[model samples]
Target: MTLQNQSGTSTIRPTIDTMDLEEIVELRTSHMVVGGAALARDANGRVVFVSGALPDELVMVRMVTAKKDFATAEVVSVTEPSASRVEPACEAWHRGCGGCDWQHIAPAAQVAMKTDMVREALSRTARVDQPVVVTGAAIAPWGYRTTVRLAVGDDGRVGFRSRRSHDVVALRACPVADERINGLLATVVAAGTDELSLRVGVAGAELIAWGAPGALVSGLADTVRIGATAVVHEDVAGHRFRVSATSFFQSSPEAAELLVAAVTRAAAGLDLGQCTVIDAYGGVGLFAATVARGAERVVLVEASASACADARHNLRGQRAEVMEMRLEAWTPIAADLVIADPARNGLDKSAAARLVQTGASRIVLVSCDAGSLARDTRLLREHGYAHRGTEVLDVFPNTSHVETVTRFDRFAPGDRANHPDHV
Candidate 1:
C-alpha cells in the first residue's frame, strides 16, 4: 500500500504476512502515549502499545490483543534499555499499583515525555498549530504530592487500586506522596476503615477516614475527621488557602504555585484596576485569593458548598465575592479576566457558551483533561477567541495526569465581524 509520509511524499508501506498472532517479538518503543504507555510499530507496520516500557527502548513484548491497525502488548523483557530507564522506587509498582506508572522512567525523562504528551494532545485534539511550552516539569518531581487517597479492604488494610483492576495493592509507603503522608502510612495498619485520605500542607497532615465513624485512634495527622470532611491549610506562592478533604487541590504544592504563576503571567499585560476577575469552578478560592490582590473585584463561583465556605474564609481580607453556583448556572458577570479550573469532565456546552458570550478581555483556562481542554478551545475559537498560548505543568508526577493552563484573547472587531455567528 502507498501512504503519504510526514514530508507529504507517497511511500510504499509494508505489511507483516508471516507474523504469528500473540507471538513475542522485539520492538522499539519510540514515544510515550498520553496514558503512560510506550508506543511502537511492528514489522507489519501495526501500532503496538506496550506498558512498562520507556521510549527508545528495544523490548520483547507479548501481544495481548491484536486488531487490524493496532495491538496492545505487555513487556516481557527489555533487550535494550533506554538511558532514562531506572529502577522504580516503590516495591508495589510491579504488583500493579496504578499510582505511579512512570516510576520506572528517570525523572527528567518523565518530564520531557509529559510535555510532549500535552503538545501532542493539543495538536491532535484542538487542531492547535502553535508549539506548546510546558513549565514546572523538573521542579522536584518526586515527593511532591501533598494529598493522596488510600483504599481499604474489608479486613481494614489500607492500599491503592491495581492498574485497571479493582484489586488492592498493599503499600507500606508511597514515595511520590509527601514525606508526612509516608510517615502517617507507616503508622496506620488495620485502621478498620473502608477508605483513607491523607493530606499534608502548611497545617500539617490531616486524615479523613471514610468508613466506620469513630474517634481518632492514633496521632497520625495534625487533625483527623471521621468522614470525608476535614480542613487543611495549604501555602502556595507565599499565600495561604484553606482546602477541605473533599475539595479539589493540586497534589503538588510547588507545581500548584507554578500554575498560579503561569496564570498571573498570562494576565500581566492586561490592566485589572477597577475591573472584575471571575474565577469559575474556583475550589477553595485558590485562584481567587491569588488574583484578588491585583483586581479591584475578584468573584469566585463554585458549585460545592464546602469549597465555597472555605473560599469565604480564604478570601476574607481581599475584595472577593464567593458565589456558590455552578459555572453553567452562574449569571455572566462583567469582567476583564475569567479563569476557570474545571474538573476532568471540563467545561460542558453551557459553560463553553457562557465563556464565549461573557465578553471578557482575557480568559485563562486550567484543565487537567486534554480532550476536554481541546474541545473547549475549539469552541472558543469558533466564537472568535484567538489562541494566545499554553503552558503545561507536571502536577502529578510518575502518572499520566498533567495540568495545562491555556490563555485566550478575544479577536479584533474586524475578525469577529467576519465570523458567521457574530452579532
Candidate 2:
C-alpha cells in the first residue's frame, strides 16, 4: 500500500485486511515528539505516534489505539536503527516496564531530544519568538532514582504499571532506581499491600517505605522502615528536607540540585534578600528552604496536608509561612516574586490569573510537561506578563519528562521601576 509520510514522499506500507485483523504496520519515523514517541504516518496517511522508537528509524509497530486522525503504536521490530539507540540499563524495560521510556536512546541524545521538545512546544504552542533556547542538564543514566512507586500485582509480583494499561510488569531488579531500592524490591512484593512507595535518603543509606499502616513487612531488612506514617529526610542543595510519605520530591537528590540551580539562575536578577517570595505548590519546602530562603518572607502554598507538615518542619528558622490550600483558591498576598512549581497539568488559567493577582514583579514557573508549560506561559503573557526566558533540566534521565524553569516579568505602563517588563 502507498502512504504519504511526513516527508511528503511516497512510501510502501504493508497491505492488511484491516487494522483489526492485522495490528502491525511498517513505517519510517520522522522527529521526536513529546511523551517519548516518534512521529510517523501510516498507510492511510493518518498520523502515527510510535513508542519504543527513535527519530529517522524504520520500524514495525503494533497499533494499540486508533482514532480518526491519529493512531498510537508500540514498536514491534526495528528494521533500521539510529546510532543513538543503546541497550537499556534495566532488563525490565524490555518486559514493558513503564518507568523509563527513553532508556533505548543514548544519554546525550536524550538530552537533545528533550531540548527539542521544549523549544518546539514554546514556539508552536506559546507562539514565543524570543529565541526559546532550552538548556539541558546532564545526569547519570542509571542507579540515580531515590524514590519509586511500586504497584503490586494480583499474583504477588511487585513492579511498575505498563504504559496505556494497569497491567503490572513484574521485575527482578530495577536498574534505574537507587541500588538500595532494588535491594528491597523483592521484600515488598509480599507486603500485603496493593501499592507501595519506597524512598532512600541520607546519601542512599537511609531506606524508607510506605504501604498500608499494618503491612506485613517483617521479611524486610532490619534497616528498612515501613508504615503509613513513614517519612524520609532528603538532603538537597545544602538543606535537609523532611519529606512525608505523601509529599513529592525529585527522583533523586541530584535532580533536585539541578532544578534548584536552574531556578536560581532563572531568578538571578531578583533582589531575593529584600523580596517576598511565594513558593507555589511548594512540596516539602524545597524552594522555601533553598532558592527563596534569602527572601525576607517566603510563603509556601500546598494542598497536601502531609506535605505541609513536612514543610513546616523543613522550613524551620526561615521566615516562611505554610498554607495548606490549593494555589488556585489561596487569596493573593503581597509577594515580590512567585516561584510556581506546578504538577504535570501545569498552571490552569484560573490559577495563573490568581498567581498574577499577587502583583508579583517576577514569576518563575517550574513545569514538568512541555505542552502545559507552553499553555501556561501563553496564559501569563495574556495577563500582561512578558516571557523573559526558559531553562530546561533533563534530570529525569531516560524519560521524556522535561523539567523547565521559566521566568516572566509583569508589564504595565508607568510601572518601569516596580515591574520591569521591558527589561
Candidate 3:
C-alpha cells in the first residue's frame, strides 16, 4: 500500500500479513478521545482504540479499517472489566443508541474527560495557553433531557439512530430524557400507526407535543407565561424564560444559567451600557434579555421566524430590537459588544469574516462544540482579536456534549507588539 501527502509526495506503507492483522488484542480504555476510546497498539504492531470498554479494562478488538498509516477497529469482547465501569442508567443508552455516548463511563470521569478534551483542542488546535475552567453538570445526569426527536420505523417502532449510522435503533426508554417524556414513549409507539417520525419534548414523561405552530401538553398549568409563550417554571436569578415545548431552549436549565452568567460577566467589563449590542443566533432571546438590562440598545438576530416571533413576544416590553435574519445574511452594524450563541456548527466563515471586519471591541461567544469553537476562535484571533478567557459549562450531563463561553478582545498596539507572529 502507498499514501500520498498533500504535496503529492508518495510513500510506501508497511505490509502486514492477514495472520498478523487478524489477531485480537486486549486494550484498556483510557480518557475519552475525540469520538471515543483512547488506545495504543501493543508489541504485535496492531492499532487499538478503546470502545465500550472502560478505563483499566481489557477488551478484544478486530481491525476493520486499516489505512496506509493508521487503523480503526471494532470491539469483539471485554475480557476484563474496569473498576469504574458501571451499569448504564438508561436502557436505551446501553442498547447501542447513539443519543448518549458516555453512559457506560463513570460520571466523574465523563466530566474530567470532557474538560480535558476542550483544553487539548484549544491548546493543540487554537494554540492558546489560557486555562480552561470547567463546571460540572448542573443537574442529575439522568432524566434531564427535555427535548428528543425520534425516528419511527416502518415496523411501528420509535427509536434513535444507530452508532455512527443512519440505521434506527429501537428503544424502550431513554434514561437521560425527562421522566415525563420517557413515559410517553409507550404512548407514542402505540400512537404511531401511520406517522413516520415523531419529535416530543418531555418535562417529567408528559408529552409536550409540538407541531409546526407549536402546542403545549395539557396538564402543565403552573407554567409561567411570558407573553404568549409558556414553559415549565425554572427560574434563574429571578428571571423566568418562557420556554415552549418545541422552542429552542437549552435542555439543561442549570447549565444554561451558568453559561448566561459567564457571558454576562465576560461582557461586564465592556462599556455595553452606552453601546449597541448584537445578539446573533439568539434563541428565545434568553441571553439577549439577560444582558439587555445594561445595554443602551440590543439587537436580537435569529434565523427562525417562529423563534423570532416568540422572542419578540417574550421581549415585548423590554428595550430591544428584534431582527429575523440569518447571521450570514444580516449586515453588521456598528456595535461595541457582539454576543453570539450560534448553533452546534458555530459561526460560518463568512459570518466570522464579517465579524472581524466589524472589529467589535468585545466578543462573547457561546458554543457547544469545542472543535468548532476553537476553529472560530482562531479565525477571529487571526482577524485582530485576542483571547481573554474561556469557561466550560456542562450542559449535557452523562454525554460528550459541553458548552463554553469564550471572551475575546480586539488587538491593541502593546498587546500583539511582542507577538508579531500572531498576526
Q: Which of candidates 2 and 3 reaches a greater TM-score?
A: 2
Better of 1 and 2 by TM-score: 2
Question: lDDT by residue for model 1 over 1-423, one digit each (tens)?
Answer: 665532345766333344455677667888877677889987667798999898888897777777777888888888889998888878888788988878888777666787777777777777777545555444586688777788876555578999759878877788887776777777665455656777776455454534346523354453555455667777887778878767778876687788888888877777777678889898888888775567899988899998998899988888899889878888887788889898997887899877666788788998887667778888887777766777877777777776788888887767755332343
Ranking by lDDT: 2, 1, 3
Q: Give me the displacement of residue 404 in model 3, in angstroms.
A: 1.3
Native-referenced Cα lDDT, model 1: 0.76
Q: Which candidate achieves the best TM-score against the true structure?
A: 2
TM-score of 3: 0.80
Top candidate on lDDT is: 2
Deviating ranges (above 4 Å) for candidate 3: 1-23, 28-30, 39-49, 53-58, 78-83, 135-137, 164-167, 190-207, 211-236, 244-246, 417-423
Residue pairs of candidate 2 with colliding backbone atoms:
none
Candidate 1: give the clashing pairs: none
Better of 1 and 3 by lDDT: 1
Worst 10 residues of 2 by lDDT: 414-423
